[model samples]
Each structure stands twice: as structure tokens, then as C-alpha cells.
Target: MKIGRNEKCWCNSGKKFKHCHYGRESEQAITKGELIGQSKNIRSRKCCYVPKALQHECDRRIVNAHTVSKSGSLIEIADSTNHVYGLKINLANIFKNKGKLVPEKIGVNQASTFKGFCSKHDKQLFSCIEDHPFNATEEQCLALMFRSVAKELYAKEGSLLSSEVIKSGDKGKQLADQLSIQKFAADNQLGIKAALRELSDFKDQLDGQLLGNFTNNLSHLIFESSRSMPVAVSSIVSPVSDFNGTIIQDLGDLNVVAEQIVFNSFSSDGKGYVVFSWLTKSAIILGFVNTLIAIDKAGIFGALIRLFFGLAENSFISPEWWDGLPDAQKKKIESLIMSGVNPFKFDPKGLLIDDGVNFSGWNIDNIRKINF
Candidate 1:
């Protein structure tokens, strides 16, 4: 909300404050009894139409989503234009120490898709134990194992992960010895396969330890990326501290990636929402959702959002009103909003109203009045 005196207006038209929406008339109209309360005749040029115009436009196009996550709760702020969304994933349930492989914790931190690459990563090392003999170069073989391990836990671009239920490593080993060393050599004909098999069960344990370290580093990078914005919820499913506390090189760069994501998310949201928010800066549209309604559906908003936010003309959304948008356009909107966010202030939390209720869920009680 705080902008510098000479800053490019967040409203984004390329003009200075003296010439933009906040021009002379706008500066004068904020006085007396006109700007704050609701009035049906607000569209008249002499009134508060200008400020309301921006808010209303933003509201009309902005997408409102509420998720009941296993972690906690999620509120996303996006429009056909801006992609900056905020999710408050709660982990209070997991830290209680009662459950195994906490879904809530993993979902909040990792946000994995449960698809392709993650599955393969898990099976990689085990597959190697089946194929290559022990005489192979442990380092390179380990790399293969690392990739496989990563795939199991991480989702890859393309591949089938086991849909069958997975067993805990400890419990699975106690019950089924499927994860083994000798089987690795029998399956692989590599030079070191046989030698690796001779290293004993204790060696596999060491390999597992090393694998944890490797995965931890990768997971850390993934986590920072997810939280820092441009808003592609991270694909990782666990927190980094779980990885035995290994320190990584270039931690600073990881944060940069986070900033990139955050910035992109906001910009995308601003642009996508422009579909609703961008009117004749002259119209008196106000409120977030109202902004969306103000859009002229024909091609004006679509053009501005696309040209400015890089959104396509069509995007796929299922709400009754959303049917008006095409899938490609929606995707483009998402991409543009994501690419234009601000990293330092990433993730668009819900707007700050003068204590308004956020309607969500089916029950009438879902509406909680706020006094703040």
C-alpha cells in the first residue's frame, strides 16, 4: 500500500501522479462525505468514482478461492491477470508427533504433484541394486541412485509413480526385504555392481544416509522456491530440517529463486485482475470483486491483460461467470500474473477491508464477521 512519491503508480499506466488517475480532481474528491460510503450515483464525474473504479475493477476479475487443506487453510488471490495468491498451510497437527509421514506438513512445505519424476526418483537406487554389479564406480552409480531417489520423492515431468500404497522404509524393511544390495548387482551388469553388493546391509544403510543428505539439499532449494513466490507452489513434500541439518552452498541463490516466484505471482495477479479492474479510470468501480464485474467482456480487458500481463485471450475456469473465459486465455493470465509479482512482498493475502466477512464453504456459519 505504501508507494514512493515518484514511483511508477501501482495502478501501472505509464503516467506520473500529476497526470494519472490520482490527478487534480481525484485529489479533491477524497474529502467531505463522498468517498467512504456506498452510493448508487457514484459514477458521476464530480464524486468518488476514480478510486472506486480501481477497486471495483480488481474485484470483478479477481478469482476468489478458499481451500480446506490438510495442513491448515488456503486463500488464493488471483484474477484473470494477477497470480499472487497466499496459502496459510498449518502444521500444528503434525508436530504433535502422533502420525507417520505427516501429509499436512509435507503438503505445506513440499506441494508435490504425486506424479512422474517423484515416483521414478524413489525407485532408481533400488533398480540399480538389481542391475549393476559391485565393481562399478560408486560415485557415478550413486549419482544414478540419487536421480532415482529424487524421482521417487520428487515428481518428474514424465513417468508413472507407484499408485499402490507405499510402506514406511522402516516398517517395509522389517516386513519385506525388497530394497536390497545383492539384487542390485544381479540386475545390473555394470563393472562395480558385484562389488557394491558385497558391501553388506550396513553399506546400504550408509548409502541411505548419504541419499538423505543429497535429497535434503534438493528439497531445500525446492522449498525456498515455493515460498518466495511467482507462486508455483513448490513440488517438494517435506521440510529441509528433516535432512539431518546439512548446510548447502549458495543458500543465497536459493532465496533469489524465491524472490523471483513471489514477484511473478503479484504481477500476474495485477494483470489478470485487470480484466475486472481496468475501466475508464473514470468509472467509479470499487471493491475487489466489483472490479471484476466492471470489465466490458468484449475484447478490451482481454487485450489489456494479454498485452500487459501476457495472458492469453482464453483461460479455463469453471465458475458460472468464468465460462466466459477460454482455457488458453486463463492459462495465459495465470502465467502473466505469476511472472509479474513482487518478491519482497510475495503472496497476496486477502485484501484488507474495513472488517468484512469472507464467504466460504456451504454452511451459513461459514461467514465469520470481523470487527477489525
Candidate 2:
């Protein structure tokens, strides 16, 4: 039987489900004792209590988003529109406690964000915040801020999004919501029509090329083909072995794919975001190379690094706001991509950034398989 993500792991490390005890469930949860000196906005109480051990199946537990501190405090996201919230965390604190963040690849799953994430000058949320309730962890603060700003942006349109719409339940879904497609381009300012064409074109092949023969004969491979480009555009899969919609296993790499997906989906103004992503990639590579050079650490990856940056500078990077990257970092990035070694096989050591994990072993893109 296939193992569900939420099921107890067969490895049995006394950790239940994923990394133990629905650990991933309440992503907003901070380690209990670690909250000792949290934020001044958070009050500590003698009544503080740790939760009891889990008894029932992890899936049976319900998530309570409105959790409060024993000191009678609740996290609040003041509606702020003038400011667009990016990752808001005290990185210095994290560096102090966790040591340096190990400088690695970082990518949000299905990592799409609004192309131009700026607020009207009058609506800036980045300004004015006396007391941050969360401490040390910028991610939590940033997430909270992103949600708050997003809500403010949505409110302007008079749309009342349900709380359920904000669940971190699926990164892909979250990325879709953030793009605000339906509203971002109600009249098509971001170019949604062209993006949808790819999907539509693929769908058309089934009807026009296959005729009715595909109605039952070839419906199964649609999702797989859409993501992986299929072995050949014309080939179809057996009906019994298809129809799964999951995509993207190596989330760090998703920084590219997700950005491409959303940028492609924009009805208008997308060219700007597309350009921005390439710039971002270029900047990362160049910056890394510069850091290495400063420390005299450049080794064999130099060529690959330069190639990655070069692609950003010379390749088809659409919009150019992202060109704001420093010149040195951009160069190294071009080198990485244009290097002789294949990116799929080079497997840069310690290549992680953010929570991205290695996907080198994935036989397919999503599910790990079994050879019985």
C-alpha cells in the first residue's frame, strides 16, 4: 500500500507522521520554551502550559488557527495596505541562535507571488511597526505580514476571502491565491489569456488529433504530460494508470518553475515579473561568486556560476526591474548555468537554500516508486 503523507512513517523513529506528531500541521507553532523572551507584544503568564501528548491518529486532530497565549494574547494582522509585506524577520537573531543560515538554495513551493509586489505610496505597510509580537523568526513575521497585506489588497476590491482560503495547506494553492488572478487582471492587465493558451492548446490536441478515440483510450496521461512534456507530445497513456495532478518535487528549483508559471499566467504586466525572476537568479549566482572570491574560495563551479548569471544578462529575461542586482553576482550566476556539466547531474554540494531539499533521487518528479 502507498504511504500517505499524513500517515505514520514506517521507519518508526518514535516520530509520528511527518517528522513526528503532526509537526508540520501547525506551522505557526513555535517551540514552547523558546518563546520565553518572544516579543514584548506577547505577554508571558504563570499559567503557561505545554500541550499533552498525542493519543489519537495525527490526522484526527483539528487545527485551531486562533490559538492564544496563556497571557491572553492573540496574534493580529492589522490591516495595512500602504505596505507590501515581504519576509519580515529579525535575521540577526536567527543568525545568533542557529548560526549562519548555511547559505543554500531557497525556493517556495509553486513559488508564485504577485509580479510587481508594491503598494500604492499611500498604502505602504512596511512603515510603522513599534512592537513585533514574533521574535527571532523572520519567516513567521513575514508570513503574517504577507497575509495582512494581501488581505488589505483584496479588501480594496471588496472581496471577502474565507479564512480557509489562507490555509498553508498546499504551497501550490497558496501561490495561486497570492497571484490574485481573478482580480489582478479582471480586464486582463497581466496577460492571462496567452498563458491559458498553453493549457488550452494541449487540451485541443486530445479532441482534434485523437478524435473520440481518446475519450476512453488516452485521458489518463493528461496531468503527467502537462508537467513533464510527456515522452512524445503524441503519445498517450493507458487509462488505468493516470490522472494525478501533483507537480514539482524539488521545491528549491520551483523558484524557477513557479515563477514561470505565474508570470506566464498573468494577463498583463507579467513581462515585468518574468524579467525580475531572471534578475533574481542572476543576482544570486553572482553574489555567491563574489562571496567566494572575497574569501578566495572560487573552485571548479566558477564556469557554471558564470553561465547562470550570463543567461540572466543575455538570455530572454523579459521585464528588467530585476536587473537591480549587483553586477558581480549576476556574472557568477550566468557561469553556473552555462557550464559544461549538466545541471541535472552536477548536484552542487550543500546546494540548499530555504527549506529546499535534494530531489536527486526522485525516479519520477513526484511520487517515489517501488520495484516489486
RMSD to true structure for each model, in Å: 30.7, 26.2
**Model 2 CA deviation exceeding 4 Å by range:** 1-315, 339-345, 348-372
- lDDT, candidate 2, 1-372, per-residue tens: 345667774334344455532333335444323332342112111111111121121232221111111011111111122111112122234445452211121121101122112222111222221123222132222222232222222222212122122222222333344335334333332233332332333334322322233322111100110121100000110011001211212323313322110001011111100100111222332333233223221221232222222221111111121244455544433333333234474433322121211111001122111110
Instruction: Return the lDDT, model 1, position 137.
Output: 36
lDDT, candidates in the order shown: 0.24, 0.23
> TM-score of predicted model 1?
0.16
Badly placed stretches (over 4 Å) of model 1 are: 1-69, 73-232, 236-331, 334-372
